[model samples]
Target chain A: MSERPAHGWQTVREEVLRRIAEKIWRPGDPIPNEADLAAELGCARATVNRALRSLSDDGLLDRRRKGGTRIARQPVGRATIEIPLIRTAIAERGARYGYRLIERQEAVAPGAVSAALGTAADAAFLHVVSLHLADEAPYALEDRWIVLGTVPEARDEGFEAISANEWLVRHLPFTRAESEFSAVPAAAARSGALDTAPGDALIVHRRRTWLGDKPITQVDMTFAPGHRIRTQQ
Target chain B: MSERPAHGWQTVREEVLRRIAEKIWRPGDPIPNEADLAAELGCARATVNRALRSLSDDGLLDRRRKGGTRIARQPVGRATIEIPLIRTAIAERGARYGYRLIERQEAVAPGAVSAALGTAADAAFLHVVSLHLADEAPYALEDRWIVLGTVPEARDEGFEAISANEWLVRHLPFTRAESEFSAVPAAAARSGALDTAPGDALIVHRRRTWLGDKPITQVDMTFAPGHRIRTQQ
Candidate 1:
């Protein structure tokens, strides 16, 4: 063996990695052992072990405590984050995003809402209903309730023209959030939101958010038919 | 008004989350607003908002600035972790995960190998070839080269009876990793090792990892038809 300074093994590992990436080799394929490789490269067998050990960590190569290293049959799934704008999503998809106000009411909080905010049962509240459109088509019909107990400023929040969804983002600094998902058969009135025939499968999401530990907002959303959900990083 | 402690809203949110787990409420469905709901339950609207907003953060809901909240659409792809398991993945699937040692040769580091390690030629190394299996079928073939210069301890390791994958995991401590994925047609020997007809689509993963700043390992993996990869939290 040449008396060259150490650090040669890294080269071995990289070349091997490239061959594998280029499909020069394949998954589940065995490779040469150390002694044989040492002779071929005119070096020592010790160098090859250093490289193989590293592949085992990233969940790419499977190495048994006693078995040799091999390419993974399955791959690690990658996640990507995708945040889209509603108007953009609609316009790009050959549809229109529309909105309509349905009903507006002011009422005294019953016991539950009052208790939620540690207020009196008659605490003031705002209630509103609206329909949403995508591509000029009915997409979602929303019925929402807002508490004005802690957010007494909400008494004049001007929700009649601006939607609650838009209002909060511009005005709030929400920090914490939680969500749940499921699939259910649609009811007649709600099923019309997705243009699906009644009794069709609809994906549903329920959510709540808080600024610190203080609850800020809650919402329930329903999607149209053939709409997909994805989270990628 | 009779004053009664309210606890059911919390219970309702919990039930809603459970319903999501049970696929009852899908990704998107508009829920009843607070006032209308208070009339039904004789409670408060604050309770409902708490439940809904919590569900939003769990990646199950889409609340827009103005479009109203809607159930998220599931993305086509998912995160799939390629757990490094050879025997279980092979035998369990009725397909085989297999391995076999090929020739081992000692030599100087190859040109590409030296460049990756930022080393000069005349560096000592070992070259090896091995075969991997699936369902009693040859799946991946490895042609690797190891460097003795960096991993001096590797000089003592032998390949006659013991496999390299087994030895490396017990010894190495890898920290950083990089991975790339692509597709390719089959090569000459790959056609035989994979038993494929050749000219078929194959998924591949190329990965390299390091211990701290010192590069530790590099590996490539290829997949056959009818193989699925899944990654999730």
Candidate 2:
């Protein structure tokens, strides 16, 4: 292989990753300091630093403030969990996507919902129930509560043409989000909606999003049995 | 609030992120180049670069080689998923953990396994079946295949004392890993092992690890109903 001095930071990053993959820099071994790496690679020290920092973010390197950087002895591979818009998720699976709005109304927030939203227990919010179908089969049932104070426009949009999921993504892009995945037994009402047997184990993907300090929305989505979510770098 | 020149890259990062969050630099707006930001902040361009790079990594900013940097119009919040060790995962949940080695044998690779491993269909591998218990209740069942050429020492370890999962983590320390999560119906064999009804939905966490180009191991772990995994950022 013809070799030339690597130029850009990304090129340096690839070189470093390849070295690590080849075991040239074994785990737990201290790599050269920034200055030395810069000298050897004939690049600016900042470029080398950027490459190292990116690798550290990927959990490939362990960098300390003073102790320098080292190959992580117990490197944990991080998988990025991208919160997918349900429509895109379904379409990616090569299935015809369908949506039906079951119910939409303004209701007093329950204790749990209010607590999760960090709002008054008696606060009223727009609550909506919708079903997502893949190939005309029930794929997921979504129960969502929208804080009107954070998303007042949601009250006017009748979710008949566009799903609240898509609406929020377009209007309010969240700065922070949390997701919880679990297997739960389907209750009677949910079973009838999802067309699954009562007590059948269903996958729940619960998510809450925030726009700065304001809670945007919280949704509990229960998927039909045999649903899958894949995460990768 | 007193204003002072930021001293370090991390402070610069915080300031930049706060700006983006507060809409001082609104989404889809082009940010100043690194040199100008460094001049404005009275720091080196490298420091500004570091801050901008970090924000980009967090999905707060979008950077293109030629297009420069801009606030992402539709920013997607990324959740870092740390691959968990089952023992540590259970212990973190405040549950007593137990393990049992159900079966271990050398078997010819099946079609799917061979395809995944990229090996001959008739190649023999060490297959293991084990069960994890939480508070004396069935928790998960693990079915694993270890490549003999990559991990020959696994043949000597009886797995009665230490699990293959922990053993591989300690010995192999794979450089790469892939994980997939899905809800699956428990088959007759898996149901008997997990003490669950056949056709009950189980959460499956399938993972494969590699050391460079060599396949190290592949495991399919099925969790009991009600199991949960949470990720936040």
Docking class for candidate 2? acceptable
Best by TM-score: 2
For residues B41-88, write the lDDT of model 1, one tens digit per residue: 555667656655765664445667666655454332122344353444
lDDT of each residue in A63-165, candidate 2, tens digit only: 9888889887662456677767888888988999999999999988778878977877877689988998899999889889998877776888999877888
* DockQ scores of all models, one per candidate: 0.03, 0.32
List candidate 1 segments past 4 Å from native: A1-233, B1-57, B61-78, B94-97, B107-125, B147-150, B188-191
Q: Please, what is the whole-model Cα lDDT of each candidate in the order they appear?
A: 0.53, 0.77
Q: Best-fitting candidate, measured by lDDT?
A: 2
lDDT of 2 by residue, B1-233 (tens): 24344577878877776675455776678899999999998888977888788777667678989889988766244567776677877887899989999999988767898788777777768999998888988888889999887677678999987778777765544556777787665653565777777546677778887765677788998888667777787
lDDT for predicted candidate 1 compared with the true structure: 0.53
